[model samples]
Target chain A: MSFLSINSIAHIISAIIGTGAATAEEILYFKDIRDGKIDEAEARHLRITYKIMHWSLIILVLTGFGILAGVRIKYGGTKTFYSPVLWAKYTIVLVLLANAVLIAARKMPMKWAGSLSLTSWYAAFALGRITEKTREIKWLADFLSKFNFVELYLITMVCYILAVAIVAIILNYLKKIIIKKQ
Target chain B: MSVLLQFSLISHIFLGLLGIILFYAVLMVLFKPIDFKRIKFLRRVSLLGLISFLSSWILGGYYYVVYYGNIVKPLIKKSAYPWAHSIFMEAKEHIFLFLPFAALVAVLIFYILGEELEQKQAIKKTVIILSSLIVILGAIMALTGIIISGAARLR
Candidate 1:
């Protein structure tokens, strides 16, 4: 395989693992906390998933740099590096890293951070798959380019909050029903 | 690009990335309650961050002085994305100068406080804010670097 292909495969695999771990972490956190607490076993499971996520992140970062370096040498200044979509992905990745730290330190209102963590991984994954030439996604790059980082962050904040709220509310109702039956 | 210029540019960026990581480590340490173990850890990481920032400054400054102005700057200015240099690079060069100083202050704070930094809630909060800014500024600089390179390459 070409070096770029190898690097791309590694990057994509790690991204999938990280995103999956984040999704599972969210579900486990919500369910475990429904009773207002998490047992040692439940917390340990969450920790394990978090560790998995971290390991994936490390691999993703290394392989990502490899791909970027390879592209830089071969493409001789393609717009890929300058794309707004790519930078947006970079921003989301930064948010994910910072959010993980906040969650670990137990600082800040975790609801926003937790919801962001869940939504951002999916957002990043989507962003990665959608390129400037991506047929249906052609408009998205231009649309995303319209705003600066601060504005984009505000938009992401509103979207994630709304999305997580809808899900959390439904989960709350389901848990109530389940408890009533028990 | 000459081999020297390329090496300097890569070294500058790599050091900057390392500095950002170390700044994140410092911020993570500050997020928790201060303690003896944490204080020791903070000292080590902050000092490393300080070194990283200082080293990046020297290397990047060398490139800016010796190579960027002569060759890269003109290319970026004439390129289609002049804003990459005019706006992003303009902001980045100035903002980057702040990092090493900020990191130095953090090192001093850690040096002076030792374990006593735990009791000084106000001081601790100040460090937290400082570290947070460093991380954000570093991230901005990284983004700006991308634009600068992209613009330079456009020619």
Candidate 2:
């Protein structure tokens, strides 16, 4: 395999690990915080989960930069680097990082940040996969070829907002069900 | 690009990255409970972030005005990746203009608030938010720099 392929694989793996760890952390936190109260042991477990997530993030970022550098070195001035999809992916990744920071600081509303985290991670992952596969998929390439990036970005934001609303409603319903069971 | 211009550009990117990393460090530290020792370390890190950001502003500004506009911009414009210049670079440059101010605010907050930051919830939150913004913008700028550099390779 070429150097780029190796880096790409590492990048993808890191992303998967990071996303999985984040998901696990979120689940653990939610499950542990019964009746909006977390005991010391549960809080410690959550902290450990966060630490694992943080390491995964560091690996993800390092491998991501590696892939980017490899691409630049191999392709020189190719349009791949300037693809609107690539830009959108980068923007989503930034949002993910920002959400992580806010979540750490307890500044963001939990439900919104959780939804944003999931949306940003999955969106970035999907975009990356699509960009990689576009070369082999004629219709996908053609569709992306004609799409305006700004419009696509705005559409993505609208979708994420709607997704957050749906998630909030579900969580509320689940909370009520759990309370009723108690 | 001339050797000096290249040096400036590389240094500019490096300093900007350093500033962003230090800002992240500040954020991590801020997220924890602040004590006398941690506050001292936070002060040092914040000052370093301020210096790195200011230096990057000078180096990047010099390169942008002197080399990028005159030399690199035209090359990328003629290349296959003009939007890298028209869109990403344009946004990067404008958003980067905010970093120095944000860094300054962070430094001033640290200087004025000192240990009192532990007690001043409102001011502490403002500093955290501003620091986080700086990190986000810096990360975007770093990524945009890569796109711009790739575009410049067409020449």
Local accuracy of candidate 1 as per-residue lDDT tens digits, A82-117: 665676677778878877777767774754666677
Off by over 4 Å in 1: A1-10, A58-70, A101-107, A132-182
Residue B70 CA displacement from its true place in model 1, Å: 2.2
Worst 10 residues of 1 chain B by lDDT: B146-155
Q: TM-score of A-chain in each prediction?
A: 0.77, 0.84
Residues A115-170 of candidate 2 have per-residue lDDT tens digits of 67766667777778888899899998898777676776666666656765787677
DockQ of each: 0.30, 0.32
Two-chain DockQ for model 2: 0.32
For this target, which candidate reaches the highest DockQ against the unseen true structure? Answer: 2
Q: How does model 1 fare in lDDT?
A: 0.77
TM per candidate: 0.81, 0.75
- For residues B1-155, write the lDDT of model 2, one tens digit per residue: 56677567656766776788789878988897778898888889989988998898899889889977987789889877799899999898788889888888888888777889989988887887888788878887888787787787742
Q: Judged by DockQ cut-offs, is candidate 1 incorrect, acceptable, medium or high?
A: acceptable
